[model samples]
Target: MKYRFALNNDIPNLVRLINNAYRNNIDKSWTNETQYVSGSRITQDQLFEELNKPGFLLMVIEGPDTRSKQLIACIGITFYETYAEIGTFCIDPSFQQAGIGKTLLGRAEQFLQIYNSNIKAINMYVLNVREELIQYYERRGYKKTGLIEDYPLDANLGMPLLDLNLIEMQKTLI
Candidate 1:
């Protein structure tokens, strides 16, 4: 697979892949949130707005199929003066557990290092109920910061099937 910045035309595909990765109705290869939440992970309009933000990047992993160069995985990174935030990360269920997500995250960190010479850390928030996902980040050198955030009431981000909170995790890259 090839990795690069997402383009304007990639919004629709990215939305589909992300929803599939997180929602139950679609082909959920892994990381399925169907048991806990319902709705699309994000909308094309939100993605388009995000893409237009300064220091906000959406990276896509492209498939190798010659006839259709599909977007197989994607993640978003937003830079700040001292640290960066990695969110909206997902891999098409078909590509999950194949080390593609790990590789993409590493490359994203490297990209952040190159983009900000003084960057100190990368922070992300994962659903507290997803213990597996929390462990996944912990194995990647992320540590819980003892902070918890309430899952917002925004329906566009998906309605929680149960009460949920977000756990903050950070990996210092300095």
Candidate 2:
């Protein structure tokens, strides 16, 4: 597999991959959010806007072979003054539980630290109900900050099936 920055042409595939990983009921994974949320995870237009942002990056893991390379996982990072925010992280359901997500996350952290010398920590938020996801990150050294952000109901990303809040987690780079 190859880890690389997403290109403009990658938006469509990225959109499908993200939505499936997050909202598809047929292919449920531990990370699936369909139980707590409904609707598309991301739209192409929104991704385009984010892609053009100055301090943002979307990384993907493509694989099998060069001739038929397919995106199996992705993560986005937004650089800040002293830290970076990780978001839109997903892996194709078939690829989960195979150590791919772990590797991709580690690489993303390493990439940010190498790409920007100023980043001292990495932050990400998980839905408060996603205990499995929260614990997964905790195992990787992220700590819950006890900061909760209200879920944006008007964001068009999805409609929450339950009252939800985003729980902030952070990992300080050493």
Candidate 3:
């Protein structure tokens, strides 16, 4: 219900939330990547480096009420010269399917429009094997750009269980 920019102290929780959403098999959701990839979704060191990058914005959605203040969702946006890239998006498994991800995504786009009016579009990369995720974005107005890039296996985001590539998806904001 509450959204704000992520602070340095949020890295550990972000790491856990992302890993559980993407890699953990116990509470599998449509977002889980464990079927196609292995290892942690992201590491603290990687997230720390990303947080310090210029033009990067990491936003978190908190649970309603001041007492609990739990992190329910998070998304990362990186502004580029002509557009922005969305990544590191996840919602707590308990929070999935309740429109939280959709609301957070809209908030991220709105933030970009306000903070960087020149940005013409928003882009994100989804693993090619994630058909359901691709459809989710498509339904949200993103179109496949027909661009495929090799997955960054060296980035330590995860190790592929099957051959994997990233496909670009874009939504024009202007």
Which number leads on lDDT? 2
TM-score for all predictions? 0.94, 0.96, 0.95
Give the runs in model 2 whose Cα sits over 4 Å from its true position: 25-27
The per-model lDDT (C-alpha) reads 0.88, 0.90, 0.89
Worst 10 residues of 3 by lDDT: 22-31
lDDT, candidate 1, equals: 0.88
Runs of candidate 3 exceeding 4 Å displacement: none
Please write out the lDDT profile of model 2 over residues 40-150, one tens digit for every residue.
888999999999999999999997665766888999999999999999999999888899999999999999889988899999999999898999999999999989999
lDDT of 3: 0.89
**Total clashing pairs in model 2:** 0
The lDDT of model 2 is 0.90
Candidate 1 lDDT tens digits, 1-174:
788999989888888988888884354465788888887778999889999999899988998783596998988999898999999898888777789999999999999998888789999999988998999999999999999999976647889999999999999996
Given candidate 1, what's the lDDT at residue 52?
Answer: 92
Ranking by lDDT: 2, 3, 1
Clashing pairs in 3: none
The 10-residue segment of model 1 with minimum total lDDT is 23-32
